[model samples]
Target chain A: MTTMTSNALCFGDEFPASGAPCFVQVDGDGLTITVESEGDDGAGEAVPFSALTVSAGGLDHDHLVVKWTRVQGERTLYLKSPDVIRAFRETVPNHLSLPFAQAAEQVQQVRHRRRLVWSLVSGAILAMVLGLWFGSDLFVELAVSWIPVEWEQKLGESAYRDFLSHQEVMKEGPAVTALGEMTHRLTEQIPNNPYRFEVTVVKSDVVNAFALPGGYVVVFTGLMKKAESGEEVAGVLSHELNHVLQRHGLERIVKSLGLLTVAAIVLGNQQGLVGMMNQLGVELLTLKFGREQETEADLTGLQLLQRAKIDPSGMIRFFERLSEKDQGRMEWLSTHPMSTARAERLKAELAALPKKSPEPFTFEWKQVQTSLGSQPVAAP
Target chain B: MKSEILYPGAFPMVRVDLAAGEHIKAESGAMVACSPTIDIESKMEGGFLGALSRKFLTGEKFFFQTLRASRGPGEVLLAPTVPGEIVILELDGVNEYMVQKDGFLAGADGILIESKMQSLSRGLLGGEGFFILKISGKGMLALNSFGAIHKIELKPDQEYIVDNSHLVAWSSTTSYSIEKATSGWVASFTSGEGFVCRFRGPGLVYIQSRNPGSFGAWIRQFIPVSE
Candidate 1:
């Protein structure tokens, strides 16, 4: 009935004392167990193979544990020889012997799953750290992209407040009116602006004009005095307006403070934005936009002048006069430095300029200059 | 042999109708239900030593069941343990296919399953490299993947990139090389795509849409860990 049938030593409850263990034999019907007690009673019993099941124990030892489940309680036969289990397994093929692999598989699955989870968590954190390490510019851009328009306006207003606190804001006056009319002429052509147009003449001798966030364009008196014609003044104002239109102030803040810091400051605490104002330094006013930003502003400024029907040649003339006057040391030159390639690009663009019958100045330039002299100002 | 895919993609099962005297060799315990006419016999194939090596080395079952249609044409339903899609590839003894180790489901009698070793570097430092199971000879071989299987045909001089973990099976004619997903050190480490297998082919490569490794991580989040 089976292949490897032989006599072997086994343990059973029937034998009180052991002599030579037991002689277990396999037959067609069942296992024949021969046992001897101390009182000289030698008896044997037969168990059908179906009435028993194997305990598939750990693999460290050489033994086969047969657990009998058909009985009332449970009885076991531990055959000392390990090869008997293989012999027993091959006889009753289907669902007879436990391979121990099934239990091992379950243990492997759990251990592997935990290791897999930890590896993935560690990998994700490593990737995030490396992402921040290799490309912080990418993070800054991503953070900047997440900034809502409302937050941008709020940041702009804060920067404007910081700069304005250090200077005079010429509120309502004939000077403000003249400045407003000129800017309005240039701004009207811009479709859908996000800013409220307000021009302030700060009584400073910097000979420079700067645009604040949220459409606050501040021009210095020194620049107004230096202008040869109303077009020259319009040229400088138009350039400054381009800076405001492009939200350069906010971009600078985002670039300087780093995206993570800005994100924490702008998105987290309410006072975060204002608290970061100190790092902005005086660079907000003397802040020189990148060469790309300068070129973009110059080109955009030219378009604004065209829309207002003002001669764009005035922008070129202002640059030529300043570059000729000094190589360095001028405040405006320090911030908005002119390069030869920039001047060449402007000249080339001017050569292809369309013929426009530009309208004349509707406001008196001298009266606006005199109003600034008069100082008839009020709180805005 | 005639076969049909039942409820593919989500819960896939292959229903094969075998004519009289026809037989199918399937992974042990893969049978869900079968017709009464079909007789099942289990054996430790390739003898005792081979069976022991197959069990211990590859972590696959040593015993396989051969379900034969005895009296008349009968049906046998077979599926893998995991939820995935199953596909059958027919061979005429002229070609062979190398599949992922655990991808084997059920196949016709003539096909042989064997272990294939990768190159030393790939074998030692690869996702599924140590032992890749190969199915060859002349028969229909069924394969299972973690997700919907997608077939990509590559012409000469054309190469397709795939994540190594998602690879199911590919034509033996295709040449492949393993490389980091990107050349940059930081990007290679940080991009999360990791290593990729680039296959240059004049044949087909079957890929799974989802990677089982990533799916396991996603599933791990919802599982409760006991202290």
Candidate 2:
């Protein structure tokens, strides 16, 4: 290394000789720098100086000094920023020439990517752990108890199964034809679906529809009789379909499973998880997906109705009709959970959608209405 | 020529380009009463997991469907179990028809299922060719190459072997089974051609395209692995 004084080396100095290589060191008023020649950019001359590397001390220094080792081959120049050099040296690593600088840059990028991947993995693990922790029936009950008791009961049970059980009394002869027809119609709606979505009508006078997991939907025949047109039925069916798509039942199942898993882990036994889940059938009956999940289903259901070209406002109208019909049935309210507020909200949503008139069609409306037969009382 | 045309929703009639007294007989009514039959057949573009998953989840035979027009538009309706919109189309001869769904084009006498199938498959699979087909009765009859047809019956317990790719349609009531050659461990593992679909019971199965794997192999003209 040859010591080159700051004064001896000008900013725009010429090469000492062609094809000669040299190293330079600078010690200027408490600053030190060393540099060596690398290679060429293949343009038949020494490449111009790109960056400077400096190891510095103290906040205040004499001059921002840099020393360079000169490789003599054609013209070359050096640049210096006194103020930046001093401050940056204190705060950051000293700058390096191109080749070493490129390697460092690449290493930094690799390190950053590794850190990101690790963080994502850790976050996923944490989420799984927490899901297993908080997902419990006891915990869910404590959380859900704040909801109205009646609202929780109706939404909590498998609506499709409940509808089927209620239909058991109406199972004689030709009623099965209507059921078969309804099933056939539903089957047409969901072609290519391996998981058949069974549609069953319960002979109850309650204006209600419910969806079950693994593709099941139930509509009360009372509700069907009240439906002014097929569009209204379509609207109600779309809502139940939304519940299925949103997997409200599946969510409850997973939550119950998660709770049991956590309980087993806490209790620390291999069979503990299995035992809790097996016992969960009764416990899960009380659990409901959160309010957010319900609202999401409402929005999704509305979209499905819109896509199906059925009038979404029919849902609001149906809700209002149900509310009016059951004005005295507060005990039923505990199960059905009808409120003026919900009706108003649903109405508002309907109002927000674009209005389209139902297409004109020759109707067998009278025949359909007459087929409803006598209006049965709501199931006790 | 005898033809059966089904209108899914409303009964719309055209003058038939023939004399006023000359009329063609076709099924017309609300979709509630008269819907077209749907025959869907799908196979994996690739194998193994597809065949297994399909065996468990999908119906064994082709999806044999009978659809009647509903109270909605005369457009073809999907998802009768829940609710789906009618797919209406506008075509050269069928330009006067109202289109409700975004895809589908109307054809003479009835809406065309193939063009709609192509468009829907393209949209859903991001340009992959349709492995699933929705064919009407007239389409099934007209699209075949042979002028004369003879029905071949399979005995109740007998099995008929056919390539999965070439199967056009089959009865929904029939049971589907898979037959594979015992080429021994390594040979079976290396050669993908040993597996075939077996059909049981009496049902008509239509075969159109050649074995998809063989066709793909023949088209490349050279083995990529060998190259």
Which candidate comes out best when scored by lDDT? 1
Cα lDDT tens digits, model 1, B57-87, are: 6667888889999988899999898888898
lDDT score of residue A4 within candidate 1 = 24
- Model 2 regions more than 4 Å off: A1-194, A205-207, A225-229, A257-289, A325-336, A339-341, A351-366, A375-380, B1-227
Docking class of 2: incorrect
* TM, every model: 0.42, 0.32
lDDT string, candidate 2, B56-97, tens digits? 333222212223222322333222221112221122210111
- DockQ: which candidate is best? 1
lDDT of 2 by residue, A281-336 (tens): 34543445566666666666666565545567766665556567644323323434
Model 1, A155-270: lDDT tens digits are: 55666777778897777776567677788889898888867766778887668887866677788877776666578788889988888787666677677766566567557765
Model 1 achieves a DockQ score of: 0.01
Deviation of model 2 at A74, angstroms: 53
| Deviation in Å, model 1, residue A189 alpha carbon | 0.7
